[model samples]
Target: MPHSQDTTPIVLTIAGSDSGGGAGIQADIKAISATGSYACSVITAITSQNTHGVSAIHPVPLEHIESQLDAVFSDLNIVAVKIGMLADADIIQLVARKLRQYTPKFLVIDPVMVATSGDLLLQQSAISTLKQELIPMADLLTPNLPEGAALVGKPVPQSEEEMGALIADLRALGAHSVLLKGGHLEQDANSNDLLIQPHSSELLRAKRHPTVNTHGTGCTLSSAIASYLAQGNRLHKAVYLGKQYISQAIAHADELSVGGGHGPVHHFFNGHVNVR
Candidate 1:
């Protein structure tokens, strides 16, 4: 049997590579595939990392990055793009330019700054460029509590009430929608994320899974959202579905023992049984 065409939704992920396989481009691909989307990637940087922390980062040259972007955008029928880590200002500007040129149907930006293991994946100087160039172009911006606070120059919200108070400021950053992750509020029993759009808001609540294997959670979540969007789900519904996916992934994290430190979520938790 000869197939004439493939109809799978193609989702592109532009991010750095995580040698650990728990986060960055690796995690994005896993999440997208697990969520039923074909995944493509363009690596901006590569990190020497593990479940413990990032040891070193080697950013790809700008021209090569541009070539990768052109190759993917020109060929693939990309429906949604999930952007993760860009190491510096130059990379951010180039990506922003390419995005303007190609303009995929849906764009999910995970403003990844600090990693779960307390490593700085993005440069402090690049923050301004990211804010000015990439953020406004996002169809959905997914930022953890610390990233949200950095975007708005405010303190990390201590409680849900404080998270509510920062919604207005977050919206002002110019993304069409924002998913403010509240997992950093470890004191809270529930992992709450606020979905703030132009005229409405919703609090997405999930049980906080008790485990240290939470590496790449943010990357997995944003990629899952992009995967859903590529599958033609509306933004609100896609976000909810993404939340559900991550929650389950977290719930099953303890099932894997990848490393000695913070480990990764089970991106394919629904697939095969983990035999001991």
Candidate 2:
């Protein structure tokens, strides 16, 4: 569908499709729409995915992705862009170039690499393209602990302070601001997230209840942040409110069971009834 608006902030998601509807563009679209922003989409790839794992991946041709972007950019009041999975380096480069040419007000990236099922969705070479081309364009970049470790060429951090320093390092590397997700970090009982910017002393912190059904949390977060930013929240405030939304999302995850292993978070946790 082409991008359309009706006095709502229009947010676009450029990402892959999850057949299981837990992660990637599916989660992004739901999250953005739930946050009261109109959603426009440009899919980068399609994955034969399930709750257990990724069975296969078919990349959308670079030109096809570009055409989708063109369809949206030509006629929408696009306020923000959230990037998720780009299947390869070439696609990454193309997306980076197009985004630079048609700059949106807010550019938020969720650097999706390894899936919750332990499958690597991004190529080894594509990491370089992501770092070199994409991160520089982002107003905010969100990466999980494993992604952070890989991007910085270091071990997964054990301390919040270490994560803070790593966030700073990644900001220096490219992202104007960074949210280093602490999902993989184990602390007492709270799930934590740390947000910081280059040379900044202030640390933005958020917490959520620990839950088993936590799939799509990252995608949900980046999309939520983008939606909030599109609606005129400052970056840090957007992140903060996004955190609250995800916390409730996690807390209410078990209201509906969608999968056997690593079920999806309840995007309709705000009491919206599922129609289908």
lDDT of 2 at 172: 69
Model 1 RMSD to the real structure? 1.5
After superposition, which runs of candidate 1 have C-alpha atoms over 4 Å from their true positions? 1-6, 272-276
Assess candidate 2 and give its TM-score to the true structure: 0.94
The lDDT of each candidate is 0.95, 0.87
**Model 1: per-residue lDDT, tens digit, 1-276?**
542235678899999999999999999999999998999999999999999999999999999999999999999899999999999999999999999999899999999999998888888999999999999999999999999999999999999999999989999999999999999999999999999999998999999999999999999999999999999999999999999999999999998889899999999999644535
The lDDT of model 2 is 0.87
Model 1 gets an lDDT of: 0.95
Alpha-carbon shift of residue 119 in model 2 (angstroms):
0.9
Q: For model 2, what is the alpha-carbon lDDT of residue 165?
A: 63
